[model samples]
Target: MNVESIRLINFRNYNSLNINLNKRINIFIGKNAQGKTNLLESIYMCATGRSFRTNRDKEIINFNKNEAYIGAMINIDNYEKFIEIKMERDKNKRIRVNKTELKNYKELYSGLNVVIFSPEDLKLVKGGPQERRSFLDMGISQIKPVYKYNINRYSKILFQRNNLLKSNKSKSEIFSLLDIFDVQMAKIGTDIIIERAKFIEGLSDICKNIHNITTLNNEDLTLEYISNVQLLKNKTNMEKEYLNKLKMNFSKDLEIGTTEIGPHRDDIIMYINNRDVKTYGSQGQQRTVVLSIKLSEVELIKKERGVYPVLLLDDVFSELDEERRKYLTRSFNEMQTIITATDVIDLEELQNVERSIFYIEEGKLII
Candidate 1:
């Protein structure tokens, strides 16, 4: 999949702008705060129906404008289609594909599958488990849109259950309600756990190879889902196991005012030669693991979707060492990539094929 062009109106720093893009690799070069990341965010929002940088859609709108608009021409399976998304103040965002409104926003998931790597992604290994979980969810959702529904539904159920646990009512008054929440949670949580396991399972081999090549074969990388469901093996029925676990933890959860066990409480463990990266690996090892995982995302998506997902690199390559940068650049040959950096990268070092570089200044894109 590739983005053919993108137009932005009142999006972040861009009041109104439009630009065509390169199918192979398009690089946005500018100093910080010059709207480098903003352009990439526009493409991402168009693809995912949400923002990776912020939760509030209004934050994406320019202060002088009441609404933000993003339009793009996407190329998939030898055909091109247009998609538009507009978010207005105090209103729900509107999305249209080929000018037809969709009742289901989830259609955007398959419309544009993207793998993004911002500088913050460097923290994937050293950061909290939440970051790792977010990485897993984004990659998985592209292939399985139902995974998106399950996660959203699971989150809502978790919030309601937590609220009940913290309510003023006596424990006896809400015990039955908690049971209902557990049933729903188990049903949806099982889907989430199963999907997550499948994703990691698909990603494991590619990630290992990436880590080995980047680290000169000195380290063997590994990934595992550290789920709360102790009997997570496929042999056991997940929903039933989940209900039993929740029941076993009811007293503790009631005391803590939160649901205790499920995907929300799960994590991913990364290892190098059987050594935990978070605790034993050095800074370089940790960053390498994250990079390998990000690149592996591109392959995993291609394997599942039969099309390479657009790659968004937010000043991440500039921070890498020369060897690492070259290695990552080599992968760009096979995919559509949008990258942001302060200085323009030399395409000669990575590609002899077509590439487009846009210089950003004061929110304007000049090719």
Candidate 2:
């Protein structure tokens, strides 16, 4: 699957822009703060219905405009698809495919799959557990729409349960709500934990190989899903354990006025030579880990989705050394990639291949 073209209006700095894309290795070259990353963000929004940089959708609209529009022409399995999204201030966004409005936005997840790698991804290793959980949830949601539904349900239950706690309602009221929420949370959370364990297992296989290649076989890299509840071994055991912990922590949660446990609190750990990379690994090692995980994500998506997802590299070439950059470029040669960089010099080697150059300047694309 690949994006054939993209159209943007009132999106961030891009007042209006449209450009065709090369099926392989399309490069967006411009200086810093010239809307290079914004271009990739628009593509990401088209694919995922959300922004990677900000949770507020209104932030994507132009300062002078109250709404933003993004549309894409996608080619998947020899079929062409048209996807368009309309964002309005103080209102929910609208999405359409092939002139038909989507009844449920989740339906948009069927064909379009995108994998984004950016400088910010390095934080996946060093950042808090929320970032890692988000990585797993977002990837899984795209592959399984049911996960999206369950997540939404789980979040809603968590919100209501927390609100009840905050109100300092009667003990009976709290117990009733907690009972309902726990049952649903365990049901959905168990599914998520199980799937994540499987994903991490698959990722380990690919990451081990990629890490060996990236590090020249000098480092042994491993990924483990760190969970307070051991869900993978026995589903019922973990669910019961999590439920008991939630009950045990009820008083503390009430004092803090927050939901303290479940999949939201789980995380994935990366190790290099049996040492935690987040705290002990050098910057370069962290980059290698990020690269390995992303490549693993690509393979995982392909294996599960049965087609390669579009690869979006946002100024990532500038983050790697020459040897590593070469390895990354060579590895993705067969996949459709849209890369943003400050200059074309780093990518001159691919000029002879099937590629196109778009010069972006202050929200404008020079064809």
Candidate 3:
């Protein structure tokens, strides 16, 4: 899959811009704060229906504008798709594919598959559990669009259950409400847990192999999914176990004013040589772990979707050593890759790749 072109209007600093993308490589070169990353953000939003940098839609709109528009033409398996997203300051965002309006953002997942690697991804290794969870959720949702619906359902049920726990209502009333929420939450949460477990297992295998090659077999990387519920191999049994755990934790949850256990509280742990990478690994090691995971994502998406997802690299080349940079550039030869960098970092590795370079300056592109 590849993006053929992208159009931006009032998005971040880009008041009005339109550009075609190269099938092999498209490089955006510029100084800091030159709308290099903002261009990538627009494409990502068209793919995943959310901004990677901020959750607020209004944040992506130019400060002086009340609305923003992003459109992209993508090719998947030789079929072209046009996706458009419109965001208003106080109104809900609208999404359309081939001129057909979608009821919600989740519907966009089925069309475009993108794997984005940015400096913020370092958070996948060094940041809190929420970061890892977001990584897992987003990655899975791409291959299985229904997974997003399940996650959304689980979140809503969890929210209501937490609100009930925090209420000043009588314990009897809360328990009655909890009874309804736990069953629903467990069913959806169980599906999410099973899906995540499968994805993590596959991702771990690929990442381990990639990390081994990248580090010359000196470091061993492994990924493990940690769930608040003791997950059984069978979904039916796992759902029962989840429901029981929710019931058992109700008293504790009531005391704390929050629902404490479920997929939302789960985490992904990266281990290097059996030690938690986040806790003990060096900065270089953590970076290697994130690199392995991202490359694994590209491979996994291809394995599941039968086509490589478009790769978006946002100013990450500067952080990598020449060896790592060469490794990344080499992969660009196989798929469409859009990269952003302050300046040319590895001209040697870039020599053989067919690429188009655009100098971005304050939201304008100079080819």
Query: Per-residue lDDT of 285-330 in model 3, one digit per residue for the tens?
Result: 8887888899999999989988888899999988887777877777
Per-residue C-alpha lDDT of model 2 across residues 100-166, encoded as one tens digit per residue: 8876555566478889999999889989989999999888887887888887788888888788888
Regions more than 4 Å wrong, model 1: 103-107, 231-236
**For model 1, how does the per-residue alpha-carbon lDDT over 1-367 read when each residue is reduced to its tens digit?**
7898889999999988989999898888899999999988888877788888888888999999999899999999878889899889998788899899877555565368888887788668878888889888888888888898888899999999999999988878778778889899998898888888889988998999999999899999999888988545663477888899898888898898988799997789999999999999987778788889989989998999888999999998767888888899887879898889898676456558668888999899775
lDDT of each candidate versus the true structure: 0.86, 0.85, 0.89
Best by lDDT: 3
Residue 84 in candidate 1, Cα distance off native in Å: 1.0
Poorly placed runs, candidate 2 (over 4 Å):
103-107, 232-234, 347-351
In model 2, which residue pairs have backbone atoms overlapping below 3 Å?
none
Deviation from native of the Cα of residue 349 in model 3, angstroms: 2.9
* Top candidate by TM-score: 3
Q: Is candidate 2 or candidate 3 better by lDDT?
A: 3
TM-scores of the candidates are 0.95, 0.95, 0.98
Give me the overall lDDT of model 3. Answer: 0.89
